[model samples]
Target: MGASDTPPFLHDAIWQERIFNGDWIAADGGSHAIVEPATGELLGRCGAANAADVARAAGAARAAQRAWAATDYKQRAQVFRKAAALLEQHQEALATWIARETGGIMPKAQVELREALAHLHEAAAMLTQPKGQLLASQEDQFSIARRVPHGVVGVISPFNFPLILSIRSIAPALAVGNAVVHKPDLQTPISGGVIIARLFEEAGLPKGVLQVLPGGAEAGEALCANPDIAMVSFTGSTAIGRRVAEVAGRTLKKVSLELGGKNSLVVLDDADPDIAAANVAWGAYLHQGQICMAAGRILLQRGIAEAVTSRLLEKAGRLPVGDPMSGTVALGPLINVRQVQRLHAIVTDSVAAGATLLAGGSHEGQFYRPTVLTDVRPGMRCFEEELFGPVASITVFDTDEEAIALASATEGCLALGVISPSVTRALRIVNRVPCGHAHVNDQTVLAEAHAPFGGSGSSGNGGRHGGPADWDEFSQWQWLTIKSEAPQYPF
Candidate 1:
């Protein structure tokens, strides 16, 4: 998986070293052999950081934080603004790289790049806002309340939605004056990790302000255990997120998690079956359904169930599934062979349990076809678990009460979408769900760069991410006061 093994199309000359500390420093832990999900080829080898490497990265970021914090807010904003421009300029190549490396379709890959750039620009704007508040307090004294950076941020990003998910926190953490040590998923070092470091570097960001270490969970554990990392932001599975939170909690370190989701999309009786089906298709199958916000379960009112399922089957079958390198592909392969097997098993077991396998339930290597299932009941695993692949479960409900009950059944509450002819009707059903983000007349897979995106319960720790709200996780509050005149006390 080195230069000698990686195909020319997948190799990046700049990623010879996997550690960044003001410069691309070499760290000798071991080599993580990356695999191309689309073709199952050796993509490249990235350096896997050991505990000592993680310590060194933390030290570099700790030293850089004081200087970065002292830098003017406008200057910080400028860096991200430049970074955003650079990202825009390279959007095409970045999108292509993501498609080839991660088995993502071109259109969705482009969206990931666009959103990543938008996050940078949003952070730039957020940093420009006033940093402190003048308060009325204490007689004859002027009081000011201010926020400051936590000094260093340890970021752990997942493989899916590599660009946007990492940038969601990184851009804002930097904007608010924190140096960051990021660990992208071991599987996607080049597209997910190195590209981020290069963008900030090309923007003239100060050395040591940001460093990326590509590796597995051990590296992330090392980063979390480091005392210098004041805050840790993680986006991954709920199982792993709990581990991160537990480790960070031991030191009482600040932690933010954007974890797993098993969200649902509801198609009400009043909705247009055609539009609802299309939205469901996009929500469930986009990026091969790897997104945390993707709809794994789709609930429909009894009257519209057959109509919507017919439309969904038509749309799903019409969409092309092939090599992501092909421009005509609407869907691409799963991220890895393991995921393909897992998804196929889920669909197979559901069908055995009497759930109808509507569209596809087959694969060739990692290239899994878009799968749809209907008549799924609670006993079926496909109806309950978060099948983070190209599989969607459709359930029909006879009443509004039953629809809300079914949609709220999933353990994760990250997000949900409800479609109805009347917005009022949609809102009525959506409001009853435990979801953190509820959208009307839209898919569950919706997020804006400026939105405060996060969830409660199993999905997240109720921490706000994106926009200025992210500052809450990366900063600290301090109150300062001064009296114009000193009063003499009868001591």
Candidate 2:
């Protein structure tokens, strides 16, 4: 059979259910069902942890940190290596579970799983790198700095990339000898949280070093505010992340927050509309546009706005929207009914604000048709808000300056994509956009595991996964100084 012939429900499996410590017993309380967004079919049920549960998980993590930290760096690297190997060995099953539970198609789900494993492998290799640096001096004295792991980290993960993002945060924190208390987004608890737990166990990690407390926002808040937690690493909305930062700051704990974005894709006059259409359509509609880096707004040169908009609409209309387990289905449902309502509100508010919908402002079940809007202004919700759905809004720009101004107007700027034939123009726009990640020839959603990734402004205040920098995030630098000859009698 061809790739399109792959069956639905291909990756469903019984998740291993257990408590790594007594704290986990309290953490695993209420239950919630994981549903395939494409078909509204139940994938599995996961525990919906409460504030008490988060506290328990935090206690477990705190209890485990000293032992994990005291282990040799090489030993920790070995555990990461073993986890990477196990993940590779079970790639098929993991990918399948992701596709079924998160409503990610087989190809996309497989890519994320592979990327997650590859990144973990890179983390394993990076663990061997020497920490800090030695400063050269005229005398025989030596001065150096070394990095040490924090005690315990609380990880709050999002749903769009339940496996990779969650593991991306947890692995680096754990590899650096910091135990982690993870609270996964409710929409993908089983797929991300449970699968990762299985890998950690298989790698022979000591019990209580990594705990998964699956639940909603309250659980995350509880985890973030715990005084026993040494740090909080969160990936979600900007407002919530700010609250987390506040709590962490009040308690004098460290924090890293990767928040929301109203990212943009700018197509210049000289660019190819066909290519631009393809990239924008995929960027806006993939995973139903639930990605944090989704191109929420598109700025087109007036010369090509109408044509590019037309082509983009046609491409989006042709995309398959059905059961996510179906290999041929390109578009899936929103994560839940609440997300559906949010998308509706964005569209409704945009229309009420005088923007016109060119296509699709409707929904049935959790499946929303790809929507496009025109005549959008700077203040409209569709143009300003982080509508985490397959919705795109367009406004024509006369010059590069105008495009840059419009793109930078939002408080949140994570990633920017500029399509221009001239390298100089691309570089110019890249410099103008106030974002952490910039793509010259492609869409904003494009990312590599080894590349540095984060956001500026409201997008992210803390950094996690991304190339060599990930190691820096997980470890703290401490300066070490020693004199070779007692400073030659204090001369």
Candidate 3:
């Protein structure tokens, strides 16, 4: 179905109808139609904003920031609590929106909603946590330092995982008393725009404190470069992230980025083949493997390589591949046809370079069957690149040294996993690597609301999201001192 033939509710959704500042308002520019990748059905449309629209949104956020910041921390936390409740109440609807908009399976979409809720709850708890610190000084003097919000934050989110990524920053930024001007991806405007804006409003969040402007590079660049925006929190590809960082840096804006990953899952000798394959399959195929921390490269110790490969092939072959909206499909569509084409190109190129296509390298519409390639060597495109799809590139290594070397040679080190019979050996491998997050006897795609999230190398700039730690990313520090006596001077 064409977007013009959209369902009434989706057609009238906030993104389709208007942008948000204090209320739903029409964009001066126009609208861009959105379609479901799974069936080429018109999902809806979002505002196509230019620099002027972003400036308008930033202006509104700026005007609202002072009053919002002055509100008590408890009051802000209360609003988040209400928002959390509202999110839970609308979980089913939100999950469906995510699935439809992002081509994620319903179960995975539901998980994203749960993660958003977890983020909201985690952000609320952050308000009651200890502020900065008290510093030791002279007997008659005392010193203190505390975090302060940066007034207005520009959140530039991505198309994939729209719900969680947008909320991941939005919740924490608001909890710390900062107004936000959000620029969600044009493709995911439903879950990222109208739904989020309405939920915050219904939760009694103050007007103008949160604004949604769905658009493309123009809007994102405007938000990043706007002098009024105190900081930017972005989640997307490394290339785009670098561009965002460049613009934000010109203004010296405080920025936090969570970029792409070409993560590794190492299968060590003596590891149980069944357990390792299970973990690897989930990490590689969940959300159709569009995750930033997916297990793109599966490294196996030569001793267990054949056994593990057979097990992984068995699991991938049996894995359900179908419509994302289906209630039971294990893997879903990629976000769009372009993404489908991109993954296929990597597979074709890798095979041309002599990589063996072990199983499943074909597509039906947006659904690409989970693919596995063996004999993938270090210099191949698939080995060196981030496929960002449900394709697993396998390479065998003779020693731990060889495995670690190959893993380290990738463009990124966002996440890594090691499976070994001994926990001690697994940890040793983890210590030898330099990724953002590591797991033993687990897959690379693990994250929680309370843990610090980021990556090293080209994965992301050295910044973290989630939990109380992100407060530093959203806020600034100020030092204060008091003295009862003022007689001594070191100079």
**lDDT winner:** 3
Q: Summing lDDT over every window of 10 consecutive residues in candidate 2, give the lowest-scoring window.
A: 1-10
> Compared with the true structure, what per-residue lDDT tens digits does model 2 show for residues 332-450?
77878989998999899899999999888898888888988988989999899998999888878999999999999988788899998898988998897899788898998977777
Worst 10 residues of 1 by lDDT: 1-10
TM-scores of all predicted structures: 0.95, 0.92, 0.95
lDDT of each: 0.85, 0.81, 0.86
Better of 1 and 2 by lDDT: 1
Instruction: Kindly list the per-residue Cα lDDT of model 3 for residues 1-491, writing each as its tens digit.
Output: 33454433333653454788878888876888888877788866677778999998899899999898898888888888988888777676667778888888887888888898899899889889887899988777889998888989999888888888898899889888899999888898878776678778877889999999898888899999999999999999999989999999999999898899789999998898888888878888888899999998999888888988899899889988777776778887888888889899999999999999988889987889989999999888889888889998999999888888877886668999999879998888898888999998889988899999998888888889877567778888989888886677889
Better of 1 and 2 by TM-score: 1
Kindly give the stretch of ten consecutive residues in candidate 3 with the minimal lDDT sum: 1-10
Candidate 1 TM-score to native: 0.95
lDDT of 1 by residue, 1-491 (tens): 45454433234566665566767767767778887787777766777887888998999899998999898888888899888887777776678778877888888888888889889888888776877899998778989998888889999998888888888889889988999999988887777788888889888899998989987877888998999899999998999999999998877889998888789899988899889988999999998898898998899889999999998888878888888888888888888777778888889889999999888888877777788898999879898788888887998899888988888886677889998879988888887899879899999898988888987688999887876687677788889888988879999
| Clashing pairs in model 3, backbone N/Cα/C closer than 3 A | 3-42
RMSD of each: 2.6, 3.8, 2.6
